[model samples]
Target: MTSSNFPKAERLLRRPEFLQFNEGASKLHTQYFLVLLKRNEGTGTRVGFTASKKVGNAVVRNSIKRRLREFYRQNKSLFISADINIVAKKGADVLDFHQISTELAAAFGRLRKKYA
Candidate 1:
């Protein structure tokens, strides 16, 4: 099995952490998700995932979160030092894995200039 290398400690868990990222964050929008990003103090990249009630029920939300995590895991070379929060938008719950990955890749590309 190819285990994910993502560190649990790098995840934004507390409300205050997420709140901090909310202010002055650069955003990338796609059909399936909205990616909000802020340059981070930490050495490596950190991330968080959120899906509102509008997205779907618990099962659907978890599915989106899983897809987001998988995208991040595979695309480490594209990242900068940042705190990223990905929020599932309407219709995201129904997206296939390839669709989700495509949107995520596009979002990362869009943020490249900003991160530099």
Candidate 2:
């Protein structure tokens, strides 16, 4: 079985890595988030989450990030070998986990079909 862990190697933790998406990434917009995806030469997929001040205060932002990370961990197999950045929009702080997951799943499904 595939491990359901969110390891360091599967995360985009640096500024440069996140900024790389600005150059030529494909963007997918959902009601609560903006997903930027770019194919990478690496075999594994890496993802990053961003919650700006516009989204909410520290507590709210962290909660959003945590939820996003958990979703990614549980559904890692749904992703392709790419670098993905998920940015939370202003109203995203209001979404519950299931709402966030549904929107994200739809967004990733489109990505999968495009890349497949």
Candidate 3:
């Protein structure tokens, strides 16, 4: 079996280690996100995409998750070795994949710049 790029390590979801990004971490919208990055602990940069019921029905929520996953998977190298949780906001569902991808890419690029 192929190894999973998005591994569920302790840094991503463990309690007591929550490190949310500043207002700048979240861009293009008010949707807040938490990023926990480390140098050498996990295998690779794993990410989790979340969308609550407030967004819409199951279809809409899954769509958002799919877009986020695609955005991260396609551009995995752009991110550092950490666990990331992407929370969805009100306008998330209404936005298209291309739009979301652009925002996500820019946001992720910022993260990469921090390490570089």
Best by TM-score: 2
Which residue pairs come into collision in candidate 2? none
TM-score, one value per model: 0.89, 0.96, 0.66
Please give the TM-score that candidate 3 achieves against the real structure: 0.66
Model 2, runs deviating above 4 Å: none
Which 10 successive residues of model 1 have the least lDDT summed?
Answer: 1-10
- Give the TM-score (vs. native) of candidate 1: 0.89
Top candidate, metric lDDT: 2
Q: In model 3, which regions exceed 4 Å deviation?
A: 1-40
- What overall lDDT, based on C-alpha atoms, would model 2 receive against the true structure? 0.92
Instruction: Count clashing residue pairs in model 2.
Output: 0
The C-alpha RMSD of each candidate to the native structure, in angstroms, is: 2.0, 1.3, 4.7
Candidate 1: tens digits of C-alpha lDDT, residues 24-95: 988888887888888877656888999998998999899889888888888876777898898899899888
Assess each prediction's global lDDT (C-alpha) against the native.
0.83, 0.92, 0.62
Candidate 1: residue 61 lDDT (0-100): 90
Model 1 RMSD in angstroms: 2.0
Provide the global lDDT of candidate 3 against the true structure. Answer: 0.62
Ranking, lDDT, top scorer first? 2, 1, 3
